[model samples]
Target: MPHSVTDTTTPASHPTASDTSGRTDALHSVPTGLYIDGVWRESSDASTIAVENPATGRTLLDIASATPTDGAAALDAAVAAADDWARTSPRHRGEILRRAFDLLTERAEHFATLITLEMGKPLAQARGEVAYGAEFFRWYSEESVRIDGRWSTSPDGKSRLMTMRQPVGPTLMITPWNFPLAMGTRKIGPAIAAGCTMVIKPASQTPLTMLALADLMTEVGVPAGVLNVIPTRTSGAVMTPLITDPRLRKLTFTGSTPVGKDLIRQSAEQVLRVSMELGGNAPFLVFEDADIEAAVDGAMLAKMRNMGEACTAANRFLVHQSVADDFAALLAQKMTAERLGAGIDDGVTVGPLIDDKQRRKVAELVTDAVDRGADLTVGGERIDGPGYFYTPTVLTNVQPGSAVLREEIFGPVAPIATFTDDDDAIARANDTEYGLAAYAFTASTARTIKVAESLDFGMIGINQGIISNAAAPFGGMKHSGFGREGGPEGIAEYVETKYIGINPLDATVRNSHTDAR
Candidate 1:
């Protein structure tokens, strides 16, 4: 998956550290060493990764990468902090989490700018992700204090049973590049709230947002060793050692399905707890009774958000045959008209792909579909510019078994397929191994419910484009992966239940006390 880098295009000159675009200040603030045990230090052997700006293909910063020795130190820090963090009162944890939420809000604009600079997301959407990211801290703050257990009588009436929820202990969170700030907060909020200490490893492509988040949490009173952030260029130097350590109680990942499965096998060596939000190939279904106008509006955000880099982004469009022509027309118009430029530029709605390789992958899929008879409604070409830009694409007359429908098309390409009825649409939608998210549009209330229930996905959105929030559990199904990352249930992923049974001595054994009574 690695590719050759060529910085052929010169980066645009911008304002220095005082500029509000925030990249200058943000880049200056990136710690020179790994943040471990609440302090910064260099890794053994001294290796670093060059952080790049996807929009301009410019080297933004050279961050010191974590080595195996550094990762071992981080794991040790978490292990040392686990017991005290677990023993800390839930109310205290909740208060700190809420404080972190407030701090994130206060610095929202800066971090959002950092997100845009690193990952090529438009500024507006980057701010939106900042808001979404902060919500987890707020939601899990309340969730931390609300976690409860129960007591019950045994069947024999001679013993009492009680169940208590305990922290899963030290954990490791491996987040993806697509949502740097949100992914870290999504896992960190619950891990800290559930009294678990953790080490965070954000994707090297986008680690600044995470580094900024770690800074904010430390400033908000997260204790030393309770949280750690380590970024490494090579996985074997860090991942293998950490995943194999028995002391690491849990490891949650948000990445590709193949990598997730590999992590599962690695975690099996220790039988540790794991939560994976992996790859997805979602289907956006539009029925005959649906409002074509409304569905088109939904389609714009559903498929083009983050330039369609999200795992939950609608990958396949299954439109009812009756309204296929109208839906395709409106969708194609909106997609082709979207403005693409640098993420920092004002009014730019669509940005570049993460890299040239990703852009080429998207291009390959589009080429395959076109050769297979899929009509190129609009935008089947790459934008000619300095940035790694690809025009938002829409396609119809899609053939069966095409790569767009079969694989996770993590780009701005929408392949439209027609179905005659509900059964056909449902079958078409459920034909993939990925089942992370599915969407549907219908006027009938009964049909809406029926389609929502019938879709084989972890989450279904009917007449809605945005479904993820801190108040709802977000994860995947089947090859899309398992375990939830948000809502009340999200905190539960970091907890373990223990049942204790108590028995009372027979009354006859205490004759002296009984006589006195």
Candidate 2:
């Protein structure tokens, strides 16, 4: 059984109250049954799994646990609606998506509060995520009308070749717990904007946010069976039928690399179109020529956002050997000032880990780094209380072989390592199985260009702390997984290319490399 967030004797009241207000009642009111055909329906199996509040270990509610039969039904709904939805004018699709964006903006704070209660991110940060998630809907809404391809003729001037883009059919959206709202909207926004039907499966740890998003979509008049959400605890049960079913043409996922690998193999059974935004181990490098104060500020924003649980969060800091001590000292001071408490609290800058399991993993990583001779500069222990938490930690004198740099430290742990120069810093930063995101601060334009071009990452933040936007591509290279999201290019993942050849006086077939989709 999960532990209670507050006293059981008190009546449920706002989550922020001492009674922890009726936040559970709000979750209970949400229809947890499988959403198919724009209607709430019971799963084939009546079993349900409890969703716990990560910060307090309290049972928020029980969501319907879907079986293979539920997966098939959702697939059937998507397949039946895909062609008709695709045939609808892109303007119409775009309009509905835009409306969703408007609704998200209007309800931003509500969603933010819900996110904080469920995922344990600070209320302020959760509000930011809600806004970030809304951007996808707005961006994709405009891109819907721009889904055009190339038109050209042969050199002989006797034949014409036409290429067009169309929806990739029904897709499955599997999102992780960290950015539950944003990831789901990122995938669904583009898929629907491109005229593809979808079934969303959010992480069980934070399904309420996605469910609430689905409810809003329905309010804005999304047609029957066009968008569905299946909130289930057992992955194999629902995913097996959905993946093996040939009707489901695509699978878009944001999660760990290992799970992405497994899904890739399973998706091969149907040759499914796949888009993966997996794990990351981002590096924040600060060169000697860089402004130390600016670097420190950037480190604070990059390393502490969402309590450093983001995939783009800085896992390790690589500082120029000369300014290493100063940077570490300043960073440790800022990190120590972070207030760790319940995310729902107004003044709580930093919140607890999602659960004891996650907290333990973070503790174990710090333990291993200390064992490997990394000196703990500040915060090396967990907080004692009813919540899952660890103090914001900083490590110096880190060994070259420490696992902290090798693995994704998805916690508020910042480890610093000194590097001789740009070449040394790039080598150390790029030395990992993941290449999701990397950042550097340098005053030299030539150095910035050199470092940016040299660093092996999909997204780079040079002289800037924040990089993600609705107009920028968000994804990674190498084992971090391919395919971009959040820009004009994001829509391409949900679209397939078709070539048309005409026989006039002569005929020919023209194809380009970008058409490899």
Candidate 3:
């Protein structure tokens, strides 16, 4: 059975009621200023940005938006802190990460609440987000100590060849609004674990969780200037300069493909090492022999997660002709039963979209697809609620080349299409340019292995929808973006490799003038 965040109870050692209240009050009332060099400083001027809880459409708090000057200060702090953090022993780094992880776990619920309020994910799901967020810190904590440099001996034992990994200096991490905690943690975790300092520019919509995380990191004894969190203006005021800064060695981001490409282009001038996990329009394939119950369960589970705002959500459902009708029928039935409301509501299974823009985009996609002759079996209308709520919609017989199938619809609209044969299914699945994740459901072992190999995706799910784990490298192929974000390969994204070799009197060294072909 899969573990759930709701299965556990808060321990006695957890923060007391008064402490919890105090933290919440502090989060709401305190200045949401730039956290640079272990201090909260105003963002140069009176430029303030208000953060809202998407669940209730209520104003949560207002924070100072980091201006160009603030961004520069953050970059400067990161550079100044990088050398000392890099020189610190790996074991000590691991300890710092471990303690930070413990602190995160202790305040998991409080942090989850922040995500629910700011990001509009259900409270239960928000807890799960925090759990996933904590896993990064825990995984990279041990990984920091395991960053081993290799050595090779010469034939005469008179010389040695050595290779080592070094932090790529100060990093600038720009996170998206969806999955606020996870996005920030994924980038910041590996960079910090590799002993690299960083400045984070969280999305303007959901900055509270990242801000709270920064406070927790500082509380856990992370050195001054090691991590700086700033809520920035949406006009790209501070963003443009952060990525273009010469001192910023690495730029990590999780966002749309267009913005990601633009950032890559801007950073390319300085040859900045870029690591991105961009948008994905993952395909969900259901073969004839698949376990219908399991496939249906997986589809609903994938769609409702974060209100289907995730990059790896099963966007295009490519079903075999034989079972296409059945899959669609069952999926629509399951989705229709899901209750939609606020995140704090215990009975509500699906919450609102992050904001008005996301809601409008989702609504437009559904309308466009329906206008193109697709059948909306379940929800097709936005629920009238206080927040940015959208009904979980299931569409069947969606035509190929429809807007829903071609574009990344980051919402709870499941588009279904039928295929006749394996070749046809594979061809149709590969039709899209986006290839972050692909799914295939099958009971036949042979078909499972074959389809898994044939799919052109970074991550594939066979007989299961769950694809993320601490041990597995997670990323995508094609426009879904480049680089990875998990496992041992994750920390490598923040490091550069160097090799050294020495020759002695007892060893034969190749002559510089000698030519060997």
Q: Of the candidates shown, which would achieve the greatest lDDT relative to the real structure?
A: 1
TM-score of candidate 2 relative to the true fold? 0.94
lDDT tens digits, residues 319-376, model 3? 9989988899899888878877766556668888888888999999999989999998
Candidate 2 residue spans exceeding 4 A from truth:
1-29, 505-517
Candidate 3 — which pairs collide?
A: none
Summarize candidate 2's per-residue lDDT along 1-517 as a digit string, tens digits. Answer: 1122333112222222334443333454466777888888877879786776666777666678777778788888989998899999999999999999999999887788778877889889999999999999999999999999998886655678899999999999999998889988889889988999998888988888888888999999799899988888788778977988878899988999999999999999999999999999999999999899899899988988988888999998999999999999999988888887777765778887888888888898899899999999999778765778788899998998888889988899999989997899999999998989999999999998998899899999998777889899999999999898989889999999999986675544455564577
Q: What's the candidate order when arranged by decreasing lDDT?
A: 1, 2, 3
TM per candidate comes to 0.94, 0.94, 0.92
lDDT tens readout by residue for model 1, 129-167: 999999999999999988889988776567788999999
Superposed Cα RMSD, model 3:
5.7
- N/CA/C clash count, model 3: 0
| lDDT of model number 2 | 0.85
Scored against the true structure, residue 46 in model 1 reaches a CA lDDT of 82
Q: Rank order by TM-score, top first?
A: 1, 2, 3
* Model 1, runs deviating above 4 Å: 1-23, 506-517
Of the two candidates 1 and 2, the one with more favorable lDDT, higher being better, is 1
Q: Flag clash pairs in model 1.
A: none
